[model samples]
Target: MAFKENYDSGETELKSKTSQDSPIHCSIDEDHPCDDGLPPIDGGRHAWLFLLASAMLEALVWGYAFSFGIFQKYYSTHEPFQGSNNIAAIGTCAMVGIAYLIAPLPIIGMILLPQIARWVSTIGVILMCVSLALSSFSTSVTHLILSQGIGFGVGGSLAYTPSILFMSEWFVKRKGLAFGVVWSGSGLSGVLFPLAIEWLLDRYGVPTTLRISSVGLFLLSIPFLYFHRPRIPVSHAVVQRRLNFRFLYSKVFLIYQIGNTVQALGFFLPTIYLPTYASQMGVNELLSSLTVILFNVTSVFGSIIIGFLSDRYHVTTCLLITTAGSVISVFFIWGFSSNLWSLYVFCIVYGLLAGGYSSTWSSIAHEVQHANPATDFSVIFPFMETGRGIGNVVSGPLSEALLKADGWQSHAWGTYGSRYGTIVLWTGITALIGGIAVMARYLKCV
Candidate 1:
């Protein structure tokens, strides 16, 4: 392929090989244009703008989902939805589960119908915003599940999938850092959104809060979507590669995926149950919400730092660090928490470790790519998400079962003596099992 330079913009365009020419544009530095005439790989103004927009969009979409604990708390205590069985399913299983489960579909669609990628995302934003508005009129839990849960989940996957594809194209060397920044957007929102949602729910009630949030999300999402687009020009003539499944057979990929699934199985427990647990301990609503705030705040920094390290270290090594920290926090700090201060400490430590785990997906992708150069890194991410999604879908019913069981009672002080003792023990066990890849690394299986 030959490059055509446009003097007006100082960008080099890649000429299409097909009969219908589609030019791919990239900024070329005047003094130091590379021999390939392609845009800078790791850093550029356009790249940064794309990253910023993607991150903000991620924050807006995920921020609300992560703050579902507040809603869970509110629903448990109030109104027609109050005392509803399996309320956790509304957030964890139905909404987030469906989101993760269907994540690959849009990515596949983008690959097969590249021209419609942006349109899909645009439609997604509208669907997501409208779902919230629709949910405001819910008179039953099933209505909330259909609208807020399934509808919102579908929209989010469509809107966000493009960013995932473009992100891989934008940054090669610092892919981990880029993903970290984008993923941290959720953590950043996690910090503020919980407080904001709690305040809104308390003052305005559920119906008004949902309607207001719907309007706010639609307005905020438009500008960001404008920047979130394909790095490569997409047209009908661009020959799409056949989807490959060879990487699924790779030992390294399997090990990492197993750990990912195991980790996710228990990772969300604290987020879903911590506020309720605190309330059960006689803490006020504001203080209970504070636990979620601390968790999210620490996770923001954790995602960035973990991502930065993954760029420099082995992916398994990074997993080991997160696993160790998560295990310690769940077993020691959270297990013994008798008051606000201890629970607060647990959230900070656990959030910093566990919340940042997904940022390492870039490292996992790079690892898979290194092992199988023909593999599409973009394709690998959604499968990893699928692994986590399996856990997300199962966690609600699983936690409910554990809570209802009669055994595992303890006389010890703190959470060990509480009904959540089994949950605490299981969380720690899963965190430890999540480090299975590290064992595989030492055994030379990876």
Candidate 2:
């Protein structure tokens, strides 16, 4: 069987292959026979163990970043960092933003240097520990940003991008569910880590919390790297093809990218501001933290369900479902809340819908790859993440600006005061606009 690339259409088609030939084989595996054979694609003892380890890695890297809400609350109220305007929020956003922003570098490296690509995750683990340890010595927010935000982001991108590529090789028919399971690790850790971090922050202070977390991450992550190995033996004989830029011109890619960016702009605001918003409502610290916990816990179920849906349904349909639910929750539940229960309800609904939206990336990747097999999963995945990173990076500044708009205050309206009214409105509007991709699909523009 031979593969042919249609440059004009940006699609790759297999030429003269029998009906029994599988298109799902890795490009590398297609060129070279496997002498030391591996387990089947979707299921096997080794394959499941690899998935478990990947999930653990996901928990350790992304879980810490997602739980930054606890740290944000601490930094805002505690000494030394207290009264700083949006500094804590900036740090958290920077960490997550940079992780998404730099995602493409590892993929490029994997393509250019397959031998060295295998070691990237190990290097990431060491860098993460070192960055955390260095962060413990920070005397100011700037220092924290440099050490925790920038350092963790770089380390995490290096560590996590490999898993994205590896996952493509591991699962075929159930790829969406596999990604959901892997991603739910962050949600699972998000549920538990907030309370634990809150306890540490209360008892030990910022420096001690940083030091302890660094050590714990090192211990939890090092063992997992061993299991993060590739299933397909990479073949050096296959000449490294020049990066395909045709996807950049595709209508479908642009439509999905736009929706992804719009959704991300508002998706992170709730997690970043929920604790502070609850505090303004006179909620206690532990309970305020509980909102985030609830969001993350419910998000676990949301990701899996959405992933299953993506596998069976069109990606556009899944996007519409998520966008509608998120927009409704923000407008109806969060926007009108007067007490803790309403906020809790908003958390559950938003987490269930918006939280799993990223899980749809697997389906989106499939859509892209189905069109252009020459485009590697590494490249396609990172491009989508980069779109979200734009929203993530801008969201910090955008959120601060919205919160500062006192003129939007409505005295008669509940939770529509100067503090949160603009934010709630902004979140809902962006979520609604994020469904533009679905509209584009209906219009046949994509």
Candidate 3:
């Protein structure tokens, strides 16, 4: 009923009969689809190019955020920022947390100023370069926070939001696979950037390293803006479509959001601390960094696999796979680890499982759109990202508290006596709770 009303009012033409009794209605005509004079959907030269550029942009924007563990370790031991409490995690979280938090702004802009949607991404790229360049001059941890944290975060969100909005236009049938490929950019970059950053920090020091990265990012991003343009034109009338809020009232969305939020609370803990943990086990710096590399490399394949799964299976089913695998890895592999080899195993397993969960957003977005086509991917994704961002915002303080807790120190269970017990247990518990989203389907709440 809602879909029919929304479609009838919009620019789309309907092909099927609109009977009140029909449970399923085709909102758009397949025979005479709304013609915006664009390339074909799902597969086309422009579509593939756009997906490629988007994936690269994803790498450039999120790669640094994903590799923050290396920076965290570097800052904690280096001069200037050394001995600063939680300063490392603060910068890392700021960049990632703010990026997720501000996702809604670009979507809102698309609604209010549809004509400018194309340029928003360009502006975001400029902001990201400027932020990184400005960060090169930092003499204190606070400066890094302002530049790399807030500046990069804002820039990344600006650049990334448009991609999410445009994706639905390009690939309706294979949206999940498209999203997976785009998301894999981060995993690919995650594998490479950690090694590169570590080498740069070792040879060039922080200021030079930051400046070099700034220039490199600028060079890498500018060319891709050409390919990231929207496939369909957003007319004034299209922008005027009434925003759908029905999904918010659905029990399914509420349950999924809660689980996603809880999972996020501990999702970043291992990423932030894995290298340091490996070092504590007497592993060399290069080897410590290798842990992150392995995690990210495995995640690249994992994202593609999970994305394919999401396309075929229910979102809740995919969530269960990630949740169960992540919980098992954290509790069994990471918890009882007494050596670097065990930590390496944990990284690979966790990366393959938890790292792919973000790809499931495509499925969730599809589900929401099916219920209300008036609601675009932009609407659903920003809300889900906001949930994850909340968890990232608090993870630094939460991790510190968990690591310092004396109660968990004396326990003989797993790695409880190694000062990392609380963090391990917390990651496992949160992951388990995140699986509660699956219950929604079973209870017929969806």
In lDDT terms, which candidate is top? 1
lDDT of each: 0.83, 0.81, 0.81
Q: Which consecutive 10 residues in model 3 have the weakest lDDT in total?
A: 19-28
Per-residue lDDT of model 2, residues 132-210, tens digit only = 8898898788888888888988898888888887786777678888989988888998987898899999999988898
Provide the lowest-lDDT 10-residue window in model 1.
Answer: 15-24
Model 1 ranges with Cα > 4 A deviation: 1-39, 234-242
Kindly report which residue stretches of model 2 are placed more than 4 angstroms away from their true locations once superposed.
Answer: 1-36, 237-242, 410-412
Q: Compared to the true structure, candidate 2 yields what TM-score?
A: 0.91
Q: List the residue pairs that clash in candidate 3.
A: none
TM for every model, in the order presented, reads 0.90, 0.91, 0.91
- Screening candidate 2 with a backbone cut-off below 3 angstroms (N, C-alpha, C), the clashing residue pairs are none
Q: Sort by lDDT, best first: what order?
A: 1, 3, 2
